[model samples]
Target: MHRLFLCEKPSQAKDIAKVLGANRRGDGCWLGSDVTVTWCIGHLLETAPPDAYDPRYKRWVLADLPIVPEHWKMRVKAKTASQFKAVKRLLGEARELVIATDADREGEMIARELVEHCRYRGPIQRLWLSALDDTSIRKALAALKPGAETFSLYHSALGRSRADWLIGMNMSRLFTLLGRQSGYQGVLPVGRVQTPTLRLVVDRDRSIADFVPVAYWAIEVALLADGSSFNAQWRVPEDACDEQGRCLNPALAQQAAAAIGNAASARVVKLRTERMGEAPPLPFDLGTLQEVCSKKLGLGAQETLDIAQALYETHKLITYPRSDCGYLPLSQHGEAPAILQALGRGDPGLAELLPHLDAQRRSRAWNDGKVSAHHGIIPTAAALSLDRLVGKQRAVYALIRARYLAQFLPNHEYDRSQADFTCAGQALRAVGKVIVESGWRRALPEALTPGKGRETQPAQPLPALREGQDCAVAGVTLKDLWTQPPKPFTEGDLIKAMKNVAKLVDDPRLKQKLKDTTGIGTEATRAGIIQGLLDRGYLRKQGKALAATPAAFSLIDAVPRAIADPGTTAIWEQALDMVQSGEMSLEEFVGKQSAWMSKQVQRCVSLRISISAPASPAAAAPWKKKRKTAPRKASASKGSAAGKRAAKPTSRT
Candidate 1:
């Protein structure tokens, strides 16, 4: 039987073809002696527009507010129609087919949707590949999975796509028509994921704008012991502070400062030192990687994902770049030494650390149970020079390599000393840390302190002293400061916020569900969703931070509170996860979403609502100036990271 393979993209197809000896190039495909491999650019078929159902949908009208399709249809893009035809032709000729796409929900949809569209009736198998390396491909080929095992993934992805269409199409049209009546001619695009995300930024801006600064005071004392001085601060009693640990009573601070200033000498009431060990951090999940890159490298979310994808597909330097898990499988441990050796050969400077590289060390990162779908992104044994990589690619690769190197090193050990002093009838405390062993911290030069803020205080070793020892009080100072407002969302902060949205919620059940699920969006689509917001002018970039536009604020206020609440995202994801596990049928999930969309439209059709931009401090939210006074409208139906979809690279075809 002629077995045919379908891939997600041309580069991925080329990689698999090289291993299968598929040298001859056919139209939009590669042909070997017995096997053929064809690819979809990203998605070959998308959900049909409203016009496909009825001719009058081409014109925007209020009566066509809730456009729910009775029978969903898939439409081929005019740009990629030829390639779709080629894949359809290949499907017609094959006796059986193999789905060799990205090992994720969107990847499954890209191949399965085409199969359904072409009406293919043949036996099918799955090539679930996490990494495109030759060894990984060959191993997967030897153990092909029955297609039924992964059929649920297609249902889950299809559910997300259909739900997006229902919300995006119906809510967008409803709101745009409403806005036009108010004399604003802008299309307001909304999604299950985007509305809540916009609300996050808008809410933050409101808090910043309304915040009033509070004054606080702190007293710092310099203590002399054995001719060496260490810094300590006066401890505020519980009676003098508020619930947030802020010293609300400035008189208490003044009294403590006066007491210290009058003291001739201080007695050390207690001194204790204890040893502590810190384990190495796990490798980067895509969210963490995007976060760190946005903070350190000054790259946008899309830019970081694009660079990582290039490293995985174009250079073959790293394993799959779209992994959500920050852990490795136990089976992958054996390949570490070879990868490290390759790294050493590629960069001669790494020779110093090669002797310490241990593949046998089982850190917290290597666990079979923790890994799902794909393991963490790490370097491959491709043996390529570092000079070939671009600046940002090299920076990201170096970070991934550093995390791997840390596993082999010893635990970062330190000695922490806490000292208590009583001076002029006031209590004071100070801490000093000494490094016992550099350990894994030496692997990354940036990791030198036991805690992140510990470096601000110098790590001088404490002098040998017993309890009740006397020491001179060198100095005392009282500093006054104002409470700062919350900073606006940076791209990194936004990604981290999106990934950990459970913290924002107050409900116990939804919080637990969000924890089980990966926040608002999957690793593959978070970038695309954020990019879409910026491209659609709902969110604008101001230096290094993000601010919502006036239209965004207006939409958030005009829509029903259910659509803008972060808790709604968790509920939707719970439904999607259930569908993926076969606990709920795809039709049931889509039916529920469509019903929700239709209800929202009907409720808001004749409702009168005011649209006002959320006010914010100019320094924090720069987009507040872009706020336009939109006219009041009589009635209109209103509208996560977005659902899992591939973040197309710069070169998709």
Candidate 2:
């Protein structure tokens, strides 16, 4: 063959091969005159385990604490070994090769590792593709990059893999052995990313356990003016209030409630009104999409990712779904009219919105400077019909489309008014909000819009009144309540926490490094990382909430703080970015990781480890096999007065 195309998966290969006119199918490949196309099933090979280096490393022992490999090795994954052989055969037959994998670091590693392993010496080129649609593919084919340009991405990916192996192989063995010595039979798996994520949950659970409820009081007064009524809250004096401005003295609140109840009217002391405008939110990156899906659709992180991937790959309904950046490239703006026109044609439901959309309008989301490896997830002109999509797929597609449509609409405008009143020698405040224009909010689904949930009160509009106007007192209600503990992490909340973990760090430098790197895991890998923790029994689910198991708590307490610190992981990521930019070599980066791994092993070897064991081996295993039926939604039980009052009536008013 004169040319060969190497793709990441069979579906991707099929799509590209059709465009290349490689119609005939060969064994694990497609055949064309003087050209061929072949694919790998994800990664054809994985990093060799420790046992592959030496037979002696099979048994877990403290003496072999740090197992550093002088020469790294790659072993063909047994499951896909046959496919690997076919690719190797195709590589040897081709005169020239093209890499057409996913456009990211991990994808680069998947293809480059094979090229090096197969010893293919030929003219090489790279295919930078974002979408699998015909137009996108053909455009990319016309402008293939030289192999040397993306060589750094392969090195960066290699550095990440080697660092992960260094930590996963050495530290996991070190901890498992220590836990065994302390009479814990369960295996303890530690990772550079997963461990830090587990730490977040463990810390949150502990905070909830250690929290003490403090009693506080609040009074709500209803006032009437010209037959219209509004609610006002009692303002506590500075001396008798807490840091949050909650009233601390029960006697003072009771006295104020009674006085307000007996009073005839309240004089408005001060009034102010201001116009506010909120710009449309940026489009969904992977992390933000997963968070919104979990909150609005009750879907898990992995579940949301699966749906998004299907939309991109199978349905051809959206652009690449694994992007971390939410901003669109300015160059892509020219295609908006075509895509918007396609949406209107495919779905008649969107016909009404078509006239309102101004394809020429550009929002802040269209910025070339902020575009990263890929742009935000958006709909493609490839979509021909929305009727083919069902259930969660349709719901997710609606969300993505709404965000795109929002960019063409004006800002959501409103008027906010605040009024201060004096009644029975006590200070009171009333706040009201009125919408001047629905604007971008018109594109949002009612369920996804603001004020849909019971937790968030609906906006109230107050009657027009002068500063010195006296409003008649309608009624007064005093409430006694207790502060609530922090809620457990949902998958969505955990995803958000992972993205913004720098806020929890103490050191300024480390914190900034984390913020710059966008926290512990990349957008592409975070869902898988979280799923691994769930599969390993490190985290448990209580309804929609997530809590760390006892084994998880034990592991967190036993490990070195640096191993569990998200900031430390962020520093490692910063170094990887340096590797990608050619500021550091792969050898130097792996060397530092090895040295650090050795120190961690040495420091923990002499220490005693204690772990909280579960009642049985089966109990400690992941909660996957026997699925727990979802609990019925209800209010707090009769015993928890504090829980029942978690939603304060005064806040609702």
Candidate 3:
């Protein structure tokens, strides 16, 4: 073939091939007139294991703790070796090549690694696509960017990969050896990102375990105004309340409750009413989608990602599923009319919503400056009947669709009223809310609506009353409650925590760095990281709550503080960003990382670790065991310390 299009996966290759009219299938590729499309099943090659450099290094020893490679090697993954051979052959024949991969650093690495491995030096270009629909494919094809434009992304990815390998290979061996010295038989796998992520859960579990609930009291008074009933809460005096305004003194609460009950009426001392307007929420970024799905549908983070991936790759219903940006590109707003029309035709349930939608009306979600490589996950013009989707998939699709529809609706408006009352020398406060306009809220599906817990109480339209008006005191309730401990991280909550880790850091400079980069792992890899922890027995799920296992606590305590500190990892991430921006060379970044790794190994050589034995031999250790001839499947794949596919290196942070 004179022209070649290389893709990240078989599904992606097929989509591009269909658009290019490359129907005739060749070995491991599709072919059309002078054009061929081929794919890699994730990375066809992985970073060579430490043993690949020197056989002696295969044996874990402290003396060989930090094995920094002078020359990194890439080996074809055994499972996909055949595909690699096919791609290599195609590269040899093609005159010009197009890199058609997912539009991200990981995707860039997947295609670039193969080009370097196969030694293809040809005129090259990049097909940056956010969606696989025919129109998207054509648009990208017409505007192919020169390969040099994205060459820096490959270097950035390589830096992240080598850094992960440096840490994973050295620290895992060092810790596993230390664990053995302490009579702990299981492997202690430490990651650049997973280690810190595990630390987050471990820290949360500790806080929950160490929490001490304090008793508190609250009083609610029911009041009647012109035969309408509403509730007002007792406002405790500053001296009798805590910082959160909760009454800590039981005697004070009882006295207030009795006074309110005895008083026949409460005089309104102050009344204030204001209208509030809330703009529609931005569309789903992968992290936000995962968070909402975990909270609403009780799905795991990885599960949500899988569903979204299917929607994008299989159903072709949404744009890129792994986007970090939640804002739509201003250019995309012009396509809203077509997408809205498609939605109305595809789902009969949306027929009622169609009338309310104003396609020309743009919301704050459309901002070119805020959009990144990929825009928000939203429905494409290729919408189909919703009946074809079931359960979680349908639910998630509805959420994406609802958010898009909301952008064309007016703001949700409401009137909030606060009334301060005096009853028997005690202060009382009543808050009331009345919906002035349902607006964007009307477009949300029932599943997306606020739950009863979030509602707290039904909206009560306050009766019209002057500041000095008196309302009858109907009844009083005294509540004896205890301050609750922190709730365990659900998969969704953990995702949010991972993205917003800057808030957890104490150092302002480091916190700002974390914010500059994505918090812990990339949006594409966080779910995988969390899943990896659960798979390794470090995190156990109790219903929807994620609790750290005993082994997790031991590992966190045993590791160097910097290894488990999210801020340190986030700083590494900032360095990687510098590499991407061409501020730092890859060689310099790797050298610094190697020196750092050596120091970490040297410092922990003599320390002993205390960890509980694994519940089972299989789950105990993925590293070496004294008596066993073979170790169980590795806690993680080789070089994937982040608990994700190494081909697409997750930011070690």
Highest TM-score scorer = 3
> What TM-score goes with each of the models?
0.91, 0.93, 0.94
Candidate No. with top lDDT: 3
Would you give me the overall lDDT of model 3? 0.87
Query: Which pairs clash inside model 1?
Result: 193-640
| Counted clashes in each candidate structure | 1, 0, 0
Model 1 TM-score, 2 decimals: 0.91
Tens digits of lDDT, candidate 3, 1-653: 79999999899999999999999999999999999999999989999999999999878888877898999999999999999999999999999999998899999999999999999999999999988888878988999999999998899899999999999989988998999898876677789999999989887777666666677888888999988989988888998889988998888888888888999999999999999888998999999999999998899999999999999999999999999999998889889999999999999987787888999998999999999778999999999999899998998999999988999999999998989999999999888998998889988866676443533446678888789999999999898877776677899999998888998999987776677777887899899999988877777776787867667777888999999998888788878888988999999999999999999999999997898654235457454343644423323211122212211312211
Question: What C-alpha lDDT do the candidate models reach, one value each?
Answer: 0.80, 0.85, 0.87
1-653 in candidate 1: lDDT tens per residue?
Answer: 29899999999999999999999998989999889999999898989999999999999998988998989999998889999999999999999999999988889999999999999999999998867778878988998999999999999999999998998888877876776677655465668888888888777666656556677777789888899888887777787776655576777888888989999888989999999888887777888888888877788888889998988898888888898888999888888888878888888878877777676788999999999778888888885788887688888888877877888888889999988999998888778888898778777756322255544356767777679998889999886755666676777788888878898888888787777776776788888888877755567776777777666667788888888887787678778889999999999999999999999999888755444332222312343454454423222111101100111112211
Instruction: State the TM-score for model 3.
Output: 0.94
C-alpha RMSD for every candidate: 7.8, 4.0, 6.6
Off by over 4 Å in 1: 447-460, 609-653
Regions of model 2 farther than 4 Å from truth: 450-457, 614-653
Write one digit per residue (lDDT tens) for candidate 2, span 179-289.
Answer: 888877666778989999989988877776666678898888899999999999899989999998899788899999999999999999999999988888888899999
